[model samples]
Target: MQITPDTLATLNNGFNAAFLQGFNAIGSQGNQYQQVCMEVSSSHRLENYGWMKDLPGVREWIGPRLINNLEATGYQIVNKDWEHTLGIKRPDIEDDILGVFTLAVQQQGDIVGRHPNELVFAQTLLKGFTTTGFDGQYFFDTDHIGYDVNGAETSWSNAGGGSGSPWFLLDLSRTFMRPLVFQMRRAPEFTPLVSPSDPNVFHMNEFLYGVYARYAAGFGFHQLAYGSKQTLDAAAYAAARTALGTQYRPDGSALAVRGTHLVVGPGNEAAARRILLAERDAAGATNIWQGTAEPLIVPQLG
Candidate 1:
């Protein structure tokens, strides 16, 4: 089958449903948790369980499978060496060795060629802000002593002012493996218009407000725009502290907030880094500003 934008969309929808089912199943089973610390490398000649071979059982499999599904829809994967393990220390080890993997997917141009419908959806979502105005009557000053002014002056403002439209930029270089990187312009348009309490807007809020979250969930990768490790680490620490609170206790504890963790599975190292970094920042770690990691691509698949 020739993978095109329409096909990719269909594939993505199916993939998401399937992926969620798999994740929920794994979560309920409790068997996946034990696999986290399993050794990827050989322990010794005598201790040869070959845990690496059981990749399907680990959480990492989620990412790879998603990527494969995207590929099946015609997206090419970009190949890059992303640092999987960092600051990791084994009891007697000195220097930390990193593990790497090559991702698979098609490029954006290729996606456009094959899946133009998908590209259209992406572009439409990527376009500039939608306009809305506040009524002058709503802004009238009650204390004003006007001759016979019925209401206050109304004005139209760019809802998504200062911040541009929310867009998902693709990393052109990592076309095959990591094809999509979303750029959410922090604009009014991006903000949820409906009040959380309003029943009429509840569903709207749930759908529109979820663009970023859905994007993050859909794409199994993140990007750290701020280049330096220290900046990233600092941001991570601060977020963790804020979420957990200064005083740690067994009870009344908040959710743990930390920097991004690798999407344990396979494919496209650079894209993985982007995904992790994005997740870390999205979780409220803003000290490390997203910088020149421009057009970061996120693979549509796992």
Candidate 2:
């Protein structure tokens, strides 16, 4: 499939995050350096394009790109220069560097999906090898099943799945265990604080305090686009409440929580706060804690 500029940018961003995380994780293991490099180099050669096959230098181009991206993202380089980073002396024998690269690419795929822009670029590099019938699938000897009904390897046929489908097939060897579900009771006195006259306040209050509310409901919180603060606050509050497991009855149907507060006009923080304070006092929520105005707290999963 053809890649668009936006898709490419998303791929790059995702790859950068994945690569940094992988590099940090593996590079911390001191003794497995050479093995790491070999795995990376082999994987890259298998997956990457032909121009990279036998470049005179020990360092691969993608290696530097991955490293640079990681470093830019505030990750510290655990190993020194690649030539001596893994305690290896021989140029041909060093595999730790390659190992790092391989881990980075795999992690990137997991986070951003397989067809990331970086993967696309790497595949494009493979065009030179493809001219010589060098398809990447055989670079690693995965397995060899016999021909299918069409006398072609079953592997060559369409798998009847699209992007995001699992490539391998295997059944779990044991029974899967299920987790316990906890049912929470609705608060008796809880009432929505938003009013129609100052809808911006509702959206803003939600944007500000809905973070904790969303977490209570079991979904993650994110920032709302800037607009009418009062309306946004009202909506945000309702959204956050719903996220926190509060059921809202509308036409006798319970709506699944979708956590985003829509605003009607330009958002004003000052006006939003004024409306929120008046509503909070009216609702008799004496324990309300006020903090410096900020859009959504930084999510800490832990």
Candidate 3:
């Protein structure tokens, strides 16, 4: 192939196609964040999430309807610009070694597709202990205050105190609401700067392939998740489940947050599998905790 106007356009289109192919493939298969996070489309640079914790329970209508003031303030998730770029030297294209660059661009797309997983697991989950949620407390804290159904102030916990490898138990039954929020202002877009007159191409003597998006991840409902740093064993797992199941709504009603998924890093994969999959325990006794929750082994958490 010769360096011509027509050929440059063709190359750009080809790379874009490759990127889309790679993106669609991994985006469907490799994404795990979607299973745990409630994806919210963002139309602005930031979104207020204070209303997320306004758990208003349905009440019996007698004479007049009770109005639960849901005017919450303060909690917000600000979208941030994220990008990835790949450079293809002119010499590589001239030598017809386009295969490597094509794969690289595809891998770039793979990265784009997996970006949410990184944000949710690597960044948000790992930082939950320190990060504040809508209630102005750590997402995984021992002193989360709320009003019970009886209009009494109550304090509940979603964290198990320990100093070991961290693991999580989450209630994924609520599709519209989740333990975490993935706010997307823009989906990743692939752009190729292959025009010969472009400054980057002219000065650097290389074509630039870039992927850009705007998004943010935040804690949604603390009651929907429980994080523990204790040892991953039957005792600890059972305790975590009890904590999640006993959560109460602000209206003082039972939240009924079941532990649907047990999330752990690679370090706890075997233990998690044993707790959720093994039919029998190491003592050769029936494992009562078997089939309790699906185990999710996230590499990012490792």
Give a tens-digit lDDT track for model 2, residues 184-260: 12211112222223344334422000100000011000111111112333444433333322222222233222322
Model 1: per-residue Cα lDDT over 235-257, one tens digit each: 43333223222221122232122
Candidate topping TM-score: 3
lDDT of 3 by residue, 6-45 (tens): 8888898989998988888884437899999999999998
Runs off by more than 4 Å, candidate 1: 1-258, 262-302
Q: Roughly what TM-score does model 3 have, to 2 decimal places?
A: 0.96
lDDT of 2: 0.23
Give per-model TM-scores: 0.15, 0.16, 0.96
On the 0 to 100 scale, the lDDT of residue 201 in model 3 is 79
lDDT of 2 at 26: 38
Whichever of 2 and 3 has more TM-score, that candidate is 3
User: Least lDDT summed over 10 consecutive residues: which range in candidate 1?
Assistant: 217-226
Q: How accurate is candidate 1 locally (lDDT)?
A: 0.24
